[model samples]
Target: MPKFAVVVCPHCKNAFIMEPGHKTVSCRSCNKRLEASRLKVFFASDDFKEAQAARGSVVAGISGDTAAFEEALPGIGRDVMERIGEDVQEQRYMEDKRKVNEKMDEEARKTKKKGQQAILRDTFEELAENGDIDIEEYWKKISFSGIDRLKFDKWVEKLVETGVAYSPRFGYLRKS
Candidate 1:
């Protein structure tokens, strides 16, 4: 299933919906880069309504506080009166999506990439032809260094998880 998140774009000072876990988001309004980690959480309409209704009570609670809070109120007021209003929260959700778009202007840019495990699995299929293959011999044939042996093991583990490859025995592999 697809997952989504609502976020406020600090670059454009606008609200936009986005998928979480992106390294960067291009602001639709300003076309500026927005680091997903720096994005602000957007409140839903219902939450906005509730906050609006409770704004008076929140001020009341703050005003009715002790002298220490009274001293802090000035700083809060400065932040509030800074000629802008925005609420930022840090929340992360996990999901995967791929976006392709065409527009009135130029063509869209996409940088899709294959994962390492998929590449290794493809190599297995091409070289071994689905037969039982010795792992060390295969790596030697490919001319990969000794350091890559551990990394290759990790890649094979990922391939096994995807149901595309399997370890039939110690130091041996076959397509699933």
Candidate 2:
């Protein structure tokens, strides 16, 4: 057989076979124009095919005859299985890291929420005790950091909704 080349389009993910003389081809999936001149194709030799077959049979003996498993073992089935095992281990490690990050994020959110509520409550109590409140001055005295802007806005909105804060002539006042 003449050494035909197979090209897979990255944009449309279509696979096509081309002969030696063909310089360009279009992808069937996206119907987009493509140049086949730069396409590179690699084919396994007969020796490789035999090795793959032997590996497949050995894997079959271990895993039993599953159609999906058989279909996956095209060449170097043992190497494929070893790679899959490594991939699974890496995936598990990544999943554990993901869970840890999620937990840390949750804890940080809770701490931030609690601190916001405490600040709001303390500010209200101080104004009430003094019998004179300056909204701008009070806000200026308070500091908010280490909190995400969106989360902080949400917390402030919740306080306003619950009558914990209200707009005054100057800026904002705490509800008594």
Candidate 3:
């Protein structure tokens, strides 16, 4: 078996060399993600220099040079003019499963954000009492406010500075 393959991009018809074993490769010229097992291996060789020369020949052949193509065709040791069709079925199933998982993750994130916003809007100031507040409790009540812990701490500091609220202790707040 060859360590490297000279394959042509099915989308752009450009030739490039790649190592096998990976599930996919991005076409160098077209920037398209290609399943490596599905591409036609134009030439295969264990030597990188040999693969490069084969790629050059494939490029020349695509550029309308029939003589270069004919010369290169004879050098293909095995599976000449055949698709590298190993694991094609399994690859299709995995690709579909990956896309479905991504979509489910996105939907989960969106639903969680909306639920957090509703919780904050409903329960925020209800946790306060008698013009005094627990900073940690307030932060928990407003978790959907999209402010992280550091930002909440900075907000508390700003409130104290502006006389809107004051911190009498490290974790307590009072209205001014």
TM-score of 2: 0.38
- lDDT of model 1 at residue 121? 51
- Model 3 TM-score, 2 decimals: 0.40
Task: Estimate the TM-score of every prediction.
Answer: 0.30, 0.38, 0.40
**C-alpha lDDT values of all predictions:** 0.50, 0.54, 0.69
Tens-digit lDDT string for candidate 2 (16-87): 454556666777678777766664332222354443443343334234354544464565556644544343
Residues 44-70, candidate 1: write the lDDT tens digits: 223333333223222323234334323
Q: Which candidate is the best by TM-score?
A: 3
lDDT of 3 by residue, 38-64 (tens): 987766779887787677766755665
Candidate 2 displacement at residue 145 in angstroms: 4.1
| TM-score ranking of the models | 3, 2, 1
Query: What's the alpha carbon RMSD for model 1?
Result: 17.7
Task: State the displacement of the C-alpha of residue 2, model 3, in Å, after optimal TM-score superposition.
Answer: 1.5
Better of 2 and 3 by lDDT: 3
